[model samples]
Target: MNFERRNLSDDQLLDLYKRLLKPRLIEEKMLILIRQGKVSKWFSGIGQEAISCGITAVLGKDEYILPMHRNLGVFTGRDIPLYRLFSQWQGKAAGFTKGRDRSFHFGTQEYKIIGMISHLGPQMGVADGIALANKLKKNGKVTAVFTGEGATSEGDFHEALNIAAVWDLPVLFIIENNGYGLSTPTNEQYRCENLADKGVGYGMEAHILDGNNILEIYNELSEIVESMRTNPRPVLIEFKTFRMRGHEEASGTKYVPQELMDMWAEKDPVDNFRRYLLKQNILRQDKDDQWREEIRKEIDDNLLIANTEADIKATYEQEVGDVYAPYDFEEIKPGSETENIRFVDAISQGLRQSFERHENLVIMGQDIAEYGGAFKITDGFVDLFGKDRIKNTPICESAVVSAGMGLSINGYKSIVEMQFADFVSTGFNPIVNYLAKVHYRWGENADVVVRMPCGGGTQAGPFHSQTNEAWFTKTPGLKVVYPAFPYDAKGLLTASINDPNPVMFFEHKLLYRSIYQDVPTNYYTLPLGQAAVLREGKDVTIVAFGAAVHWALETLDKNPEISADLIDLRTLQPLDKDTVYKSIKKTNKVIILQEDSLFGGIASDIAAMITEDCFEYLDGPVRRVASLDTPIPFTKALEDQYLAKGRFEETLKELVAY
Candidate 1:
């Protein structure tokens, strides 16, 4: 090693070399374990170790890293025990995630590293949020985020870069350009000459470096780290390298040509660095051999221990309780009294109450600050809370949610609003796959309230309006809330904001002005799983939530002769089953209604639960009334017919007469 060129001592170079070799050897052993059927499939960052380790070499001790699967060097660099890492790979209970996760899918709080989900794209935004938090705290530290050349094409990548650059956040975006996204080659992936140039367009200091040269990487990154610590700004560095193995050990590298393989073989990072140390005569043969022997034995023993350790067998009853932060709130208590307020205004009031109660609360979304959101629910928020607390994010749903998750991880309560509930589809991965599973797996706080204006009857077409509560209800680690009246909206949102778990708060856009009641301007919170009795009767029971609650009330009011028990289910997941059961038993004839598509609406789940629980109490078969199983059209007549409220009313009358 030419120590003078890199300004690194022999000991420092040796340490870097050891880190590079550890993951290489770990992968080699992991491949064996995979074939032995003790460990599952593994992602090998074998050829790209230099880039990861080099970046780790320059990271500040207190700084954070949002890492991808292939970045094994990050774990080693962070000083996570090898036994813990190996145990996790083998799904042992003693692992970081306690056997809830697998290979390269674990992180530790002590190290300030975040375990990445398979959809690693959104984490860019998450890292951006972490950097933003650091900036807000005036911490002179930086955050380093890792992704492959493939992940650079994701919208979150661009959105994160924009946020980081625009805010002058201290974040280092490291791209390991190994020329393939799974099986597709880089040439087929993008049109850019150099991926580093993308940073220049974003006004970031961009660099392209030889990823195989660890000494060069350490030397360059050291200066960049110093600059970042003093003057916070985003930087993008592309590490040009090649993947020597398949995307995973199981995914054979048949797509790679022998010529390309031979070409990259000449530049093998581990071998090149070893040769450099040998040439410098700095690698004492006896000491180096001793170190290797100890490493081999340590890895061998850890693998054996990991392969034999117990698997996780905890049930939901044991695991689900602590996923969210323990919120100290009550639903029935009155804070202040208000008369006749719109649902939108009530929601804003609830947010104001949250701000008053919690100093760490932050509200974020597109057009929310200046435009008061798409529905103007946050009309006076930006002016009251200032732009810092009431943030305006760009139109990136995935970033909005993931960044919220990041903020939550750092102890800031995040309240995010989606302009349209239908647009959450654009951010599906982070919400469903990442946020919904994070707390369940790692016992971390996934505390965030995603406020979405949903439902139809606005004539905004299919893309603008949707009832997506069912989508979140099925996702485990998330609490799904859909309130009916202005009272319920204000109460449930307040509760969701304070709860420790991630919540999908669905606000019906139509109900913002249409179906509202006199709501209290108090800071009371409703128990998440409780259902409210809007009306009590005996002939039939109508179970509904959000806009459907209003529809059910309308139907019952119109038909004075047909007495019905109307129940509004405020929270979708962690359902008020006891309330539902009592209502179904009292009425026997049950009707489930929703503004969502009937095919997979929450109504179906409620009906099925009713049949399973109250089968003998039934006076008639359960009836389901929901929107048509097609795109919500723009025309009013078609939309009115499609919602099937009349169909539900006819069914209600039939059941009443029967």
Candidate 2:
């Protein structure tokens, strides 16, 4: 584990030769298919096997490995069956993704390997979160991530490294600077002499090594692995190498100079390692000939079997059911009742009750630790559950969300607070493409809860006061929950925490204190996507959610002449179309009320659904009462005008008169 030079035994040298040759042999066969126009394309790791195999050589079988596109060496070194790998690239059912996904973007959970993300930076943050879980469990396993030089420019790179350094996470960042970000030269990409120096700015140590030499990579990573097992600090190392071929099979090496290419080909990792072994008398010429023949035969046999495997049927394609996690939770009956529980207190108590029930629950956000969160809803949680259970993250919204995803996939449920709903735009990639679709892609569970404190009435301007539920409501593969009262907030949150899918819990800022009700002290769970009929009337039906539920009640109370039924849609994605249709049948007049702006918001979706499902039942057109299409203002007077709370009253009167 020391940095000093050490001699390798004959057996160890032979092992390195095999690992180095495995990827090279497989890629050569794949390119032949590409040239024949059989295989689609390939991104070969021809000269970089030393770096990929070197990192995996030191990893424990139980430790997690997150790999990028050009890391077939990890698969070959890890001894993943060649037939499975071939079937995947061939788009056969025997593939890891059942032929639904193409390319090397697939992995087995049993092997502790995760597939690559196209937008690769967020995976680094996920690696940090997985290491956090290992630290909490007191398991001495380190997480390693592989990415290209160009990826370091992303903001997630800085956010991930800073958190790992400050939290002392056991994560190894392996950067392969192969002189190009797909045709863009290294000099044009970054001004810094070494990409490894970016780690120092984040308060972590870094090392640079010759990636073309397998011995150098294997030596330094072994030391880094041993040091991180007990001490657990993030370490970064840049593996300098060259891409021998074009970026992919179709793209020729026109941009790369012939002189540089020839120079790098002379020092190719696999060929160099083979020569070193030959000179050391480790492998005889006759034995070397047999080794190459055996590897070539294995590739041919696997490729034949993989091509014959069954393709996925169209009827069995991924659907809405596959998007969310498979779950079944019976409603818990409340054993005790409590009085005057504020909305915020109910949320805190609800989370506390979950900790007592489930052991894998952890809450995380920006200021949720000793300072007890921005709203103090999580006050005293750090002392009660400890910092490991209640984590305080840096002001990085995207990292925090993706980190929760990493934890969730590794068998932990993370409750992530967005601080404000309006800020979710900054983390859209991970939330929409990653967290939302992870289940559908590979059947991975994203069992994380995003607690979004949303809506206006606090005079918090557009940055903090905006209602953005419509954005998430439109996205598939996620459940959107916005509760009205303390009773519903506590009940719905409990159900959300128990849900197998990722649940978005929206808490209107105005309801935190202004709304209080008698909530049960004991735990209970309400059904998600079910509507609650606050008042039953025959004249008209007003469907609402979040703070709009309260406004609906106020409107009905102020105008006794307008007899209407107020229905609170507790969950938005699985909107209670059955309830809306039933109410519309009797009332014959409908109105949808929401806090979000008018154009292309939740109200628009509901109105469209009503017209499509129960179009003939309505006596009047579907009306909507919502805030005008503008950002919420700061001043209370202007905000009140912007919110237009009185419109529900006027709309209800006109509908009743109709």
Which candidate comes out best when scored by TM-score?
Answer: 2
User: For candidate 1, lDDT tens digit of each residue in 1-658?
Assistant: 2333456778898998898888887778777878888777788888899888988888876888888888888888887878888877766777877777776665567888987878778888888778877877787888899999998888889988887887788999999999889999999989999999999888999999899899889999999989998999999999999998999888878999989999998889998888788778878777678877887888899777766777678787667664554566555586566778888888888998898898788888888887887788788887788887888887878887888888877768888888888888988888888788887677778778898888888888888877878788877788898887888888888888878888999888888887657887667877789898888888888888887787787777787887778888888887998988898888888888888889888889888988898999998898888889998888889888788676888877777777
The residue-level lDDT of candidate 1 at 91 comes to 65
For residues 296-382, what per-residue lDDT tens digits would candidate 2 score against the true structure?
999989888887777667654455567677888779987575778889999988988887788888888888888888899888987
Per-candidate RMSD, Å: 2.2, 2.0
Evaluated against the true structure, the overall lDDT of model 2 is 0.85
Worst 10 residues of 1 by lDDT: 1-10
Q: Which stretches in model 2 have alpha-carbon errors above 4 Å?
A: 1-7, 316-318
After the best TM-score superposition of candidate 1, give how far the Cα of residue 231 lies from its true spot, in angstroms.
2.0
Runs with alpha carbons beyond 4 Å of true place in candidate 1:
1-4, 314-316, 319-332
What lDDT is obtained when candidate 1 is compared to the true structure?
0.83
Alpha carbon lDDT at 578, candidate 2: 90
